[model samples]
Target: MVSLRAIVEDETTLLNALSLTIPEREELASITHPAQRIEWLACRLAVRRLVEAQGVPYAGLQKDEFGKPHLIDSPWHISLSHTTGWAAAVLHRSRPVGIDIEPIRDQFRRVVPRVLSDKEITHAASDLNRLAVYWCAKEALYKLYGKRQLTFRDHLHIEPFADHEDQLVGHVRLPDHEEQLMIRCFRTGPGLLAVAY
Candidate 1:
């Protein structure tokens, strides 16, 4: 099972709203862009909230060599995603998990060829909502893989589903190994969230 949470707030409320370790403070300082810093803070605070909800001490986060964030001193696997003003996080007890949030936009139409495969493109039919779902699903799959070698069009595949469906099938195809995962979608405030595990 996976637990998910989303946080939406203004810049002032999020600033210094959560406790940070020395390393986390330094990491925040290293981020130069104001928007990026806000995103970083929001994601950390959101994930920390999830950790505390489970009655566990939030020891902060650590990234593996592949850049996947893991809960320090805990057995939970975690994934995070943020866009503009929304940040989301997912946690699973014993399985790798991925979650992505994205707002539907016209730009998905332009990036269709780059993000979706021929089969997926045919299934999407240039619809913005479908394309947005595909994008979020693939991004969740990519984060689940937790490696940098895969491409959306080549390695990650999401089976076609009907409009208004909340569940879909996703496959991560590699040269030597392949695994199928179940993906769940939710209608978040102004966007869609896809969770793969």
Candidate 2:
């Protein structure tokens, strides 16, 4: 099983407290933008706590160009996700991984045409759950790509699936990389779908 942990900070104040507990808190706290600072703190704290729990050092954490986190010195692969008042990270000693959590809403449907192929939209149009599966699948791909300048529709493609809310099949169609990605979706709360790859 994949090792995953989630922390929900109901308020900005609580999130700030968690951020200040990280060793790199001072450096991140210096960031001028509030959003950036909070994100930085959340990512650092989550990774650090995970590493420490596993009896590892903070130096093991590393960031890639796309800001994907990896373990430089440890044997674990890691993925991170966050939303309004929640932050989550997963670590595993084997297998590349990706995680994403999104607040479920009809807004996702409006954007579906922009990110999904005509075939995909035709398949998912009737079902809200299926649409969310597609959204989360593409999002997982985006997190894996860890780079900018990717068009969700043109560059990423997810195979059409039946109207099932629990799972979906995704395919990444980038020029040099084409991989079948499996996506598992869960309702973490009233209007949220959390996916992992």
Candidate 3:
């Protein structure tokens, strides 16, 4: 099973509404910017709500050497992403998961050479929405892989899919390992959310 949630809230409101553990508060202290602090806290609150909804107590989170977030004492795997005003998270019962949320922007066109392959660029066809999907899909895949030194244009690949298609297939091609994963994408308000597992 997979559970996902996204929320938009200002820093002051998030600070007032959510309670934090001592460790969580200590972690928050290291983030000096108000915007980043809000994103951090909001993602945690969203994850806590989703876990508690499943009758599991929220035990906070820990990160691995690769910086992948894990439920401290639970069986679920989690991934988090935030952009501007939005924060998003995903929890999976038996497998590693990745989630990313991004707003569509014109910048997607400029990064085509760096972020997409020939076929992916052709599939996008200079369309901002399609480029956004490719970007988010690759980002989700990168987070799922949870390692370093992989490039979107080289290591991660997304199979062609229409703008209206909600599902996608992604490939991770490393010298030592290869993987195929399922990805799902959907519009969320002014942005798109992608989840890979």
TM-score of each: 0.91, 0.75, 0.91
10 residues in a row with least lDDT, candidate 1 = 1-10
Instruction: Give lDDT tens digits, candidate 1, residues 1-197.
Output: 33334455555677657777787778889999877778788888888888888888788887888878888888888998887777788888789999998888998898888889999999999888899999999999999899998989999999999999999999999998899999998877558999998
Predicted structure 1, TM vs. truth? 0.91
Q: Where does model 1 exceed 4 Å of error? A: 1-15
List model 2 lDDT by residue over 94-160, tens digit each: 6666777767778877888688888888888657777777777788767765667678888877776
Per-residue lDDT tens digits for candidate 3, residues 1-197, read 33344456677778676667676788889999988898897888778777888898887887788878888889888898887777788988888888998989999999999999999989999999999999999999999989987999999999999668999999999999999999999888448999999
- The per-prediction CA RMSD against the true structure, in angstroms, equals 2.0, 3.9, 2.0
Could you give the candidate ranking by lDDT, starting with the highest? 3, 1, 2
lDDT of each: 0.85, 0.65, 0.86
Lowest-scoring 10 consecutive residues by lDDT in candidate 2?
1-10
Question: Each model's number of backbone clashes?
Answer: 0, 0, 0
